[model samples]
Target: MAKDSSFDIVSKVDMPEVTNAIQQAQRELEQRFDFKNSKSSIDLESDKIILVSDDDFKLSNVVDILESKLVKRGVSLRALDYGKVQPASGNTVKQEVKLVQGIAQDKSKLVIKAIKDSKIKVTASIQGDEIRVSGKNKDDLQAVIALLRKEDFGIELQFINFR
Candidate 1:
């Protein structure tokens, strides 16, 4: 009898990489002439990033710097869920951006449903924050991968632990 192959589908962020990117952006903000005295700052909370600036233009500049640093560190922009900018005191504005790491409960269900709808001979189970898809044939697995890649989940995903 032949054994079935499997892979884990996940959306995970490397914390160290994210920290490095934040630090790099901070350094740039400090050294850049325009932002040096602009009183702009970036803060990373548990699940979100807060950007505060003296004005809208400064806020945009700060966001651009952060995005560039994230890209340099191999973090996809799609993983960043940006929120609305709110006005603060003294002509300042604040923006909160959430980082999507693991798949949420609703998304997990969607993934399973999609896999089942594909009519492939496979088993998909939601394991904690990730989805595990297993099948007897590698071709079916490849097709699943292709289907997943075509879906817009608003977060970056990676297939790992293929066996």
Candidate 2:
């Protein structure tokens, strides 16, 4: 019997790189003239980033600086999902941005369902935070990759560990 080929589908982010980017952004915010006295700040929590500012314009500027830092650190914008902004007391605004790492349970199921619906003669299993698809033919797996890339999930996906 011929050896089967397989690939692991995952949406993962390097936390260390993200942390470094955040740190760099913080430094820039502290040193930048516009931000130095703006009373705007960026805070990184467990799974989310909080951007606080005196007003919407400052908030947007902070976001832009953070995004530039992320790009410099090689982090994809798709990995960071932005949430709606809300006004806080004292004429301030706060925005929460989520750092998505790894596929969630619901997304994993959706991926498997899509593969099955495509009838590509491949087996897809949802592992912890990832989906593994296997098939006898490499072409079928390549097709799967192409199909997945076309779908918009709002998260950056990477095809890894292909055999």
Candidate 3:
């Protein structure tokens, strides 16, 4: 009998990187000529990022800065679920960007289905916030990973715990 090779698929973010990106965006916001008197701000909340500015245009600029910082830190833009820009106090606009940190139930199901439909000999089981995929062959496991990577699950996925 042969042992099964396996790996775990998970959606997670490096908090330290996210924090560093936020700090960098903040510094840039403070020094940017257009934002100096615009009262633009980018705040990192518990699980969401808040962008505030005098209007939608400035708010979008703040988001662009934050996204660039995140990209430079190797974070995926898909990990951010942006909300609508809404009116705030004093004629300001605010936008909430939710950080996607876990694989939702439906998304996990989609992953499993994709693997199954790929005709690859692998078993994918959802484990809490992650998915465990096991197969008899390492090449099959690699194939599974490649297949998953070709699809957009709307969340940033990391493959770990290969054994």
Number of clashing residue pairs in every model? 0, 0, 0
For candidate 3, give the lDDT of residue 101.
89
Using Cα atoms with residue i matched to residue i, what is each candidate's TM-score against the true structure? 0.89, 0.85, 0.96
lDDT of 3 by residue, 1-163 (tens): 8999999999998888999999999999989889877878888889899999998788878888999999999999999999998989988999999999889999999999999999999899999999999999999999998888899988888999999
**Mind giving the per-residue lDDT tens digits that candidate 1 earns over 1-163?**
9899999999988878788899899999999999866878898998889999999899999999999999999998888999999997767899999988899889889888989998999999999999999999999999999999998876688999999
Best by TM-score: 3
Clashing pairs in 3: none
Error of 3 at 149 (Å): 1.3
Candidates in order have lDDT scores of 0.91, 0.90, 0.92
**Lowest-lDDT window of 10 residues in candidate 2?**
32-41
Per-model C-alpha RMSD: 1.8, 2.2, 1.0
Best by lDDT: 3
What is the total number of backbone clashes in candidate 2?
Answer: 0
Decoy 2 TM-score against native: 0.85
TM-score of 1: 0.89
- Model 1: runs farther than 4 Å from truth? 89-91
lDDT ranking, best first: 3, 1, 2
lDDT of 2 by residue, 1-163 (tens): 8999999999988888889998998898899888766778888898899998889898999999999999999899998889999997777899999999899988888888888988998999988999999999999999999999898876788999999
Q: How accurate is candidate 1 locally (lDDT)?
A: 0.91
Write the candidate numbers in order of decreasing TM-score: 3, 1, 2
